[model samples]
Target: MFTLAIVGRPNVGKSTLFNRLVGKRLALVDDQPGVTRDLREGAARLGDLKFTVIDTAGLEEATDDSLQGRMRRLTERAVDMADAALFVIDARMGVTPSDQIFADILRRKGHPVLLAANKAEGRAGEAGMFEAYGLGLGDVIGLSAEHGEGMADLAAALRPLIEAKPEDPEEEAEADVEIDEDDLGEEADWAPTVRRPLKIAVVGRPNAGKSTLINQIIGDDRLLTGPEAGITRDSIALNFEWGGVPTRLFDTAGMRKRAKITEKLEKLSVSDGLRAVKFAEVIVILLDTDIPFEQQDLRIADLAEREGRAVVVAVNKWDLEENRQEKLAMLKEQFERLLPQLRGAPLVTVSAKTGRGMDRLQEAILRAHATWNRRIPTAALNRWLMGMLEQHPPPAPQGKRIKMRYITQVKTRPPGFVVMCSHPDLVPESYSRYLVNGLRVDFDMPGTPIRLHLRGQSDANPYKNKKRAEPSRLRKHLSGRKPD
Candidate 1:
């Protein structure tokens, strides 16, 4: 697919344009300049044309190792990777000196440049639109990415460029092939034609090396990383293949305590990270060895469990730890004590900087994912429930025996079960915990959230609530005469 990178100075609505084209709010957009700190890629569709669009960080003049400087380098890297660059300018503010400088930079790069005069919806933007032509990149296309104006002109300009590239023969052949049902084997019924990628979200407190861990996993400096906390603002999702399994990894902003989050942008970042957790099938909670399992870390892990996502606790920066054995033991003890809900979850020690223990982490993640999607047969479930009831029956509440009837798995993906009983409401919380623990042990389901629902049988008669019909006087007299 043809790849286009949206490049511009701070607060030029590059992310807005990217979101508009992608038809999803994948990137975080705020009025604050430099809200974007990493390069975000999305499958964008304009009219009938489909291509990959990259939303890059705002280009800055900083050349040193500051945060802005890092952002600049990452954006430049995007420009190099993209087939073409869509240079966006704020028409409402007119062309600034910074825009001119960036235009020169793009010219030096020698890629196809498409000048977009964004926010050109009203008369006030006309002067800036006219000023944009002076940059001499090419004919300026005036469009409002926010209001969806001038997209036709933008698409018209891009069609020739996108179509000029030849299609891959292999892709074309694969697209043309049709599957025959008769030729499929038994396994084909259960297997998916297109394997879905596993979604994993890496979350933790500020400066926990979440970005660094993802970069190491992808073996690319795809994310912006530094000593700075909260370097990542948006929850960026990247698709890649790991250990022959297709996966999508989300690098989220660090979540701090609610009282500490005073800035509006940080709040947005935190909320975005939370949304990633909800969407993820597996959540890898990255922790710093220096201060592992902080209150915030526990909160993050608990949240993932509550959200019913498979949890994997990863301790990062192990390369710097001298007392590995002692630290690992303490970490295990603490993990079991603090987060018992995620009991038996994988606790992996890794070094995101040096690429250590990543293999173990990957295995743990796959295992957790399998366990999350595990399902047991109804017969097996009922047998297990019988054994559980025999070993430790439910308590008699108010002199009434709560008969534990049977259990059946209703769904997978965290494995939800519904238990039909006489009085489900009277079941104690401790008894439920006992059953949940037994499931984790007997069924070999660990680290995955187990949802147990207790249900009572409804009344057998459907018309039990309806009033009974009155007997007619003639029918009563006939019955009395027969008896006589």
Candidate 2:
């Protein structure tokens, strides 16, 4: 679908207008200026025309040119991405110099421009509506963006340009795959389809350079990467071939802890990142290297393991460090200590700024992928279980010794196992962890969640068989006495 970007100075009713146009409260609307700090994109439909509508950073001037300049850069990128620009100006405030400045920039781009004079509900707006013509953009749309009045006029004004490209309902439906995502069932993850293009997710805490690393990997500024934290709001998946292996790469939002996610959009973004990890075969947990193992970092790593994904540790911003080798050793040591579940999993150091060690990063991902898909045979698993049991037998509970008979590989692609025995419930969680760790060490499965299940086959009931033999015993005794 094509895109239409909403751009204007602060408090010009951009969010209100965005909420109205998208028919959903996807963007937060408040009377405060500069409430929106990030570029928000949503799907919008006008009549038969379906397109992506982009809501941009509200233009604001900061003293000493703080992050506002960076915001302007992001907005500029939005303008470039859009096929058309929606320039909104307040009718009450009349035309500002900032409006003219933005208009000139959009004009040079030679893209279609639609000027809307918002808050024109009263007769007071007539003069301002007429004055919009002086801004040199023709046919200004005058309507109350908040009340949804004059939307038809707004649509009519922009219809000619977009109506020519009306979307097919089928195409529109396919573009928006509103999957529950939880519905993705347990199937062979290493099937030919998944192997054809490995799904790689770059996950980390905020300002960990997730977007920067993605930009480097794809070798395109396809993702919006800036020095400011939380520049990326959506978990964007792009298809490409990496190192001759077809791959679907996902660049996720810089994940902050649940407490830190104050906004609804950010919360959605973090959930989306989690979903990406669930679908991805290999996950690159990008650590900022500066603060090696924060609570949030462990939370992310634990999440990947829970999802049963192959994990690779990536230490970014290596160039910024003073003692490279020492820092790397410390970082790797922390990774090993804090994230022992991913033991022997690859640790790659890359400077997203300079693209150093990106090749090693990819190499590590493939190796982890292979480890995640490793399948152990039933015989090997049973042997390993025997050794494990001999080393540390299951303790008796209340004078009843628990028996573990045998184990077998139930499945693979995150290898799951089933141990059949008596008193399965008596097996403690610690012992289960011991078995899982032993399997990891012996079978070469690393950075994946090995699921183990226990089944108790109540040893055949001696009383039931004894009752059945009672009648046969009398007949046997009579026949033996007659023979004597």
Highest lDDT: give the candidate number. 1
Q: Candidate 2 at residue 420, lDDT?
A: 89
- TM-score per candidate, in order? 0.91, 0.73
TM value for model 1: 0.91
Q: Write down the lDDT of every candidate, Cα atoms only.
A: 0.89, 0.78
lDDT, candidate 1, residue 135?
Answer: 96
Number of the top-ranking candidate, with TM-score as the measure: 1
lDDT of 2 by residue, 1-484 (tens): 5789998898889878887877765555667577565666666766665567778887655433466776777777888889889999999889888888878877888988899999999888888888899988888899787898778887777677776666767655554443221112211112133245677889999899997898799887666666778776656656667877877677787888787688766776677678778888888999987887899989998888888888898889988989998887888788789888777778888999999998898888888888777777778777888888899988887787778888988777677889987888887888888888888878877667788999987877768756444446568687774332
1-484: candidate 1 lDDT, tens digit per residue: 6899999999999999998998877788999999999988877889999788999999999988999999999999999999999999999999999999999999999999999999999898999999999999999999999899999999998999999978977655665444222110101111123676788999999899999999999999999999988899988877788988977788899999999999888898999899889878999999999999999999999999998999999999999999999999999999999999999999999999999999999999999999999989999999999999999989999887787678999998889999998778889999999999999999999879999999997545889889989667788787784432
> Each candidate's root-mean-square deviation in Å?
5.3, 6.9
lDDT accuracy of residue 111 in candidate 2? 82
Q: How many clashes in each structure?
A: 0, 0
